[model samples]
Target: MSRVKESIEVDVPVRTAYDQWTQFESFPQFMDGVERIEQRTDKLTHWVTKISGVKREFDAEITEQIPDAKVAWVTVAGEGEQSGLVTFQPIDPTHTQVTLMMDFDPEGMAENIGDKLGFVDRQVKGDLKRFKHFIEDRGTATGQWRGQV
Candidate 1:
């Protein structure tokens, strides 16, 4: 497995950032390669992605979630093996630090080569940067889910 971690500072409170994240379907607005996300339930999500001409579909189950703090998930059934975590830290009343970490296994030769070349790392960094812009520009979360698990 390969791991990638990236973080960004957004001009939004931790609560706002965390709330926006709970709306998983909005991920395609900022997450590159994420074609769509369907929130099947509070703890389950289905994902569709296409990167570098490879398309994949997967289901991920949220393993842990703490409002305004962190969320973690692991793939249950999918075209790939992966797990991830995202955290929100309050830098101040109007600033938040969002961090994302992911672990994935390279499935084939192309993926193995891309992994060696740091493709996933770069993608995650870019995704976080876009997320910063997405949330900061909105100035408020599209929606929120305060439930804990």
Candidate 2:
């Protein structure tokens, strides 16, 4: 198992950031490798991604979610499995500290090569940077799913 954690400060309200994150289908807009994210339910999601020329799909179950604070998830089932958490810490009313951690499988040669080359870490940081720009500039969410888990 490998874990990568990255954090960024977004110039947006905590709720605004958290709410935007909840808008799962819009993830592809800022999340670089995410080809699509389908919200199966409030606590479950299907994610398809392509990175370093490798494409994989996964299902994640949200284990815990606290509005404006944190969202944690574990892999339910998929081609590539992982567990991770995303926490939102309020630095101020207009700023939030966003952190993400993930543990996943490096399946074979391609996956291992990509991991050894620091491709994953760089990708995570790039995604966070894009997300920062996305939320700070646009206060409205792309879409939202408010059904209870």
Candidate 3:
């Protein structure tokens, strides 16, 4: 398994950042390689991704969630095995620090090589940067789910 941890500061409140994150379907707007995400339920999400010409589909179950704080999930059924956590920290009334941590098993030769070359780390970092722009530009969450998991 390989692990990646990345963080970015966005010009938004913790609640704004956290609420925007809950809208899973909007991930494609900022998350590279993520073609689509479907929120099957409050605790389940289906994902479609294509990276370096490889396409994959997966289901991830939210293991923990706390509004304006953090969200965690593990793959339940998928083309890959992975788990991740995202946390939001309030830097101030109008700034938030968002961090993401992921653990994944690289499948096959190409994935293994990419992982070793730090591809995943770069991807996560880029995604967080895009997310910063996405949320800061919007200045409000597209949607929000406040339910506990």
**RMSD values, in order shown:** 0.6, 1.6, 0.5
Q: How many residue pairs of model 2 clash at the backbone?
A: 0
For candidate 3, write residues 28-129 as lDDT tens digits: 999999999999988999999999999999999999999999999999997999999999999999999999999999999999999999999999999999
Estimate, for each residue in 1-149, the C-alpha lDDT of model 2 and write its tens digit: 77799999998888888888888788899998899999887788999998767788989999988887778889898888788888889999888999999888889987888888987888899989999999878876665544433
lDDT by residue (tens digit), candidate 1, 1-149: 89999999999999999999999999999999999999999999999999999999999999999999999999999799999999999999999999999999999999999999999989999999999999999999999999998
Model 2: what TM-score? 0.92
lDDT of 1: 0.95
Error of 3 at 50 (Å): 0.5
Q: Which stretches of candidate 2 lie over 4 Å from their true place?
A: 143-149
Candidate with the larger lDDT of 2 and 3: 3
Residue-level lDDT for 134 in candidate 3: 96
Q: What are the lDDT scores of the predictions, listed in order? A: 0.95, 0.85, 0.96
Candidate that would win on lDDT:
3
Residue pairs with backbone atoms closer than 3 Å in model 2 (clashes):
none
User: Which regions of candidate 1 are displaced past 4 Å?
Assistant: none
lDDT of 2: 0.85
The deviation in Å at residue 17 for candidate 3 is 0.2
Candidate 3 to truth, TM: 0.99
